[model samples]
Target: MLNVARTVRCIDDAACEEVQLFTEEDGEPERLGEYRSVSGLRIDKAKVRDARVFRLWGYHIPIIVDEEIKAALEANGIVGGKFEEV
Candidate 1:
């Protein structure tokens, strides 16, 4: 199973005002997507949704954010924070 750390960091690859998420699959890092944001570090819900960041175990959207962010995302109809295999 692939696991991404909850910590978010900024990439310094000359891409300005955008955040990039690189997914590690099979020991290879692939560019998931690049999202444009005002601060470029604060990942918003839409970008998360677009990137499908919560998905794991073959398309299940897992809860990956903290309570406050989880609550806010849930309020907006995004399900996620704790995850388990069934």
Candidate 2:
């Protein structure tokens, strides 16, 4: 278990061109098919430095977390959520 406290921060300098913008279909809001995959995700680490948790603009389905948070969750036996590197 991590003995140190973790502070979550939010930064707006992250950018990912690979993610497709969400769109509406049949009057229902939906994300483009491409957004379903996180392959080729490119985020500028310098922009989001020190941020332990954050969500990208226009895409909120997956809440991004840093290594510390990930470890904490795993150490506590968190379930029902998938963790993928950005």
Candidate 3:
């Protein structure tokens, strides 16, 4: 699960489509009830402006974001983890 600073209920696109999520590791995704079939396409911080972090289960994760998400993490203790991208 992503430990995003904001209390995210879900990840929705501009169209409000729920982004399909899957697991590359284990346990985490299942915990948050998120299942997406990802291609391991990781984005750099430079391109993470549109990204939003989510928690599959409970494993705190860092995700892409513009200003809002970034501020959220920094404001929350989760950012103290000093975690980068996966």
Candidate 4:
């Protein structure tokens, strides 16, 4: 299961760009990606605007996804653990 924790740290696009995504490798945070996926391919603008920090499994996956992504994930058996605000 993947656990996601939403944060209000990203108040705007520029600020969101400053956020970093990391992987929980060896029980530690490892730099893996950035928050610029919002400008990537096949992404929903509305969803990117509402993006939040998702703790995917054990990695802090800071990326953007829409309801379709969520639905697909759930449909594939991934579930949210709990509601967390930060």
Top-scoring candidate (TM-score): 2
Question: Positional deviation of 32 in candidate 1, in angstroms?
Answer: 25
State the weakest 10-residue window (summed lDDT) of model 3.
9-18
lDDT of 3 by residue, 1-86 (tens): 44456433333322322344545465575445453433332433343344465442322343445456667768775634444343
Per-residue lDDT for 1-86 in model 1, tens only? 44753432323334335433435543433434433222322333433443333432222233344456556766887643353221
Question: Cα RMSD for candidate 1?
Answer: 11.6
User: What lDDT does candidate 3 reach at residue 34?
Assistant: 54
lDDT of each: 0.37, 0.55, 0.43, 0.40
Candidate that beats the other on TM-score, 1 or 3, i.e. the better one: 3
Please give the TM-score that candidate 2 achieves against the real structure.
0.55
Estimate candidate 3's alpha-carbon lDDT, on a 0 to 1 scale: 0.43
> What would you estimate as the lDDT of candidate 2?
0.55
Pull out the clashing pairs in model 4: none
TM-score of 3: 0.24
Question: Would you list the clashing residue pairs of candidate 2?
Answer: none
Model 3 spans with C-alpha error above 4 angstroms? 3-62, 80-86
